[model samples]
Target: MAETQKEILVRYLQSAREALLWKLDGLGEYDVRRPITPTGTNLLGLVKHVASVELGYFVSCFGRELPVPLPWLEDDAEINADMWATPDESREDIVGLYHLSWEASGRTFDELELESEGEVPWWRPGQRTVTLQQLLVHMIAETNRHAGHADIVRETIDGAAGLRAGVSNLPDEGFDWPSYVDRVESAARTFRASDG
Candidate 1:
């Protein structure tokens, strides 16, 4: 049977969400919280960031607000609050908040049609207005982009790489990691030589 547009979009959105969350699996709290990059991108924090984005784009845009306090969205809040969880905030706290936000956003998807009207006040004038469909696509793009970041960050942490667990989205084809790295590095050196 043919699926509805909303169903298709929801499936993709959930897949990206799952991919981001999977990066945190089998890791300790400290590992999940620890900053893996100079930019301080951590597994738990990525979950936090996406939760905030989901609420903002889905609930807040539709002239509604999540019934929760998000101080990070405030003008006076410290920088990067949305990007990293503080010591006081437990891993479960942020992850639960994210799932709750998903529920609220999912409700929005259920209650409104794709063409339902919404406003993005932060966007520059003349482009604030948007439809539910547009927001859905926007989130898929944003979340998947972050999922890719999560993938690389996860790989950097423990060599776990894929679209999700048990799914090898990469082409290994029996090539070893060291051999693959050598080939890739040699190609880069060749390119550099050709440029110079």
Candidate 2:
């Protein structure tokens, strides 16, 4: 049977989710949680952020009860509290919450029609209302954006880069990355003196 629109959206969203999680594979506790960017983006933190946001979109925004309360999102919590894990929060804690969120979101996907309307309380007044379809696309884009961040952060951590495990979606086995980078750099350098 042909997949429905919801199924298609779910597929893309799941792919991005997997890619983001893949970045944390085979890494130590410190590596997964440490900030790789000036803005403090980290692999596991990406997982946490996405999980929390996904819950907000799929569960809370639709008037569905959250599987569990997210303490970090409370008003009194520190800024960006959802973006990193505390020492007390183990890797399993974050990953477990992510998985639980997936289950809750999957239920949302199963029960809601694409055109079902819901209001995003956090959005601007005029734009607060959204349909399941819109939120699905929004989340797919958002997840992929974070997955791209995870890719660069993972590459910087240990020179690992790919779409996912066993599927690089990059150049061939014998491709020379260093030479390619040098060539690309040389081309850009040619414009250095031309700029006024």
Candidate 3:
């Protein structure tokens, strides 16, 4: 049977989620939690942030309370609290919350028609209203964007880059990446000024 629109949306959303999570696999705790970018992006933190936003969009925006407690999202929480896992927050804790968010989001998907309308509390007054379909697309984009970040962060950590396990989706396995980088850099250098 042909797949439904909802199924297609869910499939893409799940794919992005899996890709983001896979970036953390086989890494030690410090590696997963440590900020990779100067702006402080990390693997476990991305998972936590995604999970928090998922619950907000799928659950709370639809007139339902969050199924899990996210103290990081509370009014008094520190700025960017959702962007990094604290030392006390175990890898399992963040990943577990993300798993729970999948369940909560799944229920929302199962219970609501794509046209069902909801309000985003944090959005501007006139623009807070949205349909489930719009939110699905928005979330797919959101998750995939962060998944891309995870791809770079993971690569920086240990040179692992791919859509998922056993699927590099890159050039030939033995391709010379160093030579490729040199050629690209040399091309850019052709436009450089002669000044020291």
Candidate 4:
């Protein structure tokens, strides 16, 4: 059976979301919150920012009202609140909120036609309208880019690698662990030497 364009788009969006969330699997709150880059991009913060942008584009832009008020948007003083998780926000709370945002965004996408258009209030007044298709593509690109960051961040944090939980298909138990590490370390040293 041929997959519809909508199905493909939804699948890609969901895949990206899963990859981003997978980055947090088997990690502690402190590790997830620790800033990985000079820009302070932590795992939880990336998840939070993705959730905020997804809600804005898929729900707010489509005129769907948010179920709960976002104090960050209401209070102009803390404009950057959407970009980072606050101290009061726990790992579970932030993850749950992100899942909720995903559900809301998915619902809006499901109900609206690809041709349907809406205005982004934050955009310049006269040029605010965009089609649902455009937003979906934009979001897929945005989410995938962040998912890549999550992959690198996760690897740096705990040596956890790969896009999804089982995407990297390795043997179940017969593999030798020390040999794997030696090979990886040798490759790293060779690359560094070549660069120097």
Q: Best lDDT goes to which candidate?
A: 2
Q: Candidate 1: lDDT over CA atoms?
A: 0.90
Clashing pairs in 1: none
For every candidate structure, what is the RMSD over all alpha carbons to the true structure, in angstroms?
A: 1.5, 1.1, 1.5, 3.6
* Candidate 3 ranges with C-alpha deviation above 4 Å: 194-196
Better of 3 and 4 by lDDT: 3
List TM-score per model, in order: 0.95, 0.97, 0.96, 0.82
Residue 175 Cα positional deviation in candidate 2, in Å, after optimal superposition = 1.0
lDDT of 2: 0.94
Mark the regions of model 1 whose C-alpha exceeds 4 Å error after superposition: 172-174, 193-196
- Model 2, residue 99: distance off in Å is 0.7
> Tens digit of lDDT per residue, candidate 1, span 98-147?
89988999899999999998999899999999999999999999999988
lDDT of 4 by residue, 64-128 (tens): 89866666666564766766678898888778878998899879877988889977888797878
Each model's lDDT comes to 0.90, 0.94, 0.94, 0.84
User: What lDDT does candidate 4 reach at residue 15?
Assistant: 90
TM-score sort, best first = 2, 3, 1, 4
Point out where model 4 deviates above 4 Å.
Answer: 124-127, 169-196
**What tens digits encode model 2's per-residue C-alpha lDDT throughout 1-196?**
9998899999999999999899999999999999989999999889999999999999999999999999999999999999999999999999999999899999999999999999899999999999999999999999999999999999999999999989999998889999999999999999999985
At residue 39, what lDDT does model 3 achieve?
Answer: 95
Candidate 1 vs candidate 3: the lDDT winner is 3
lDDT of 4 at 190: 77
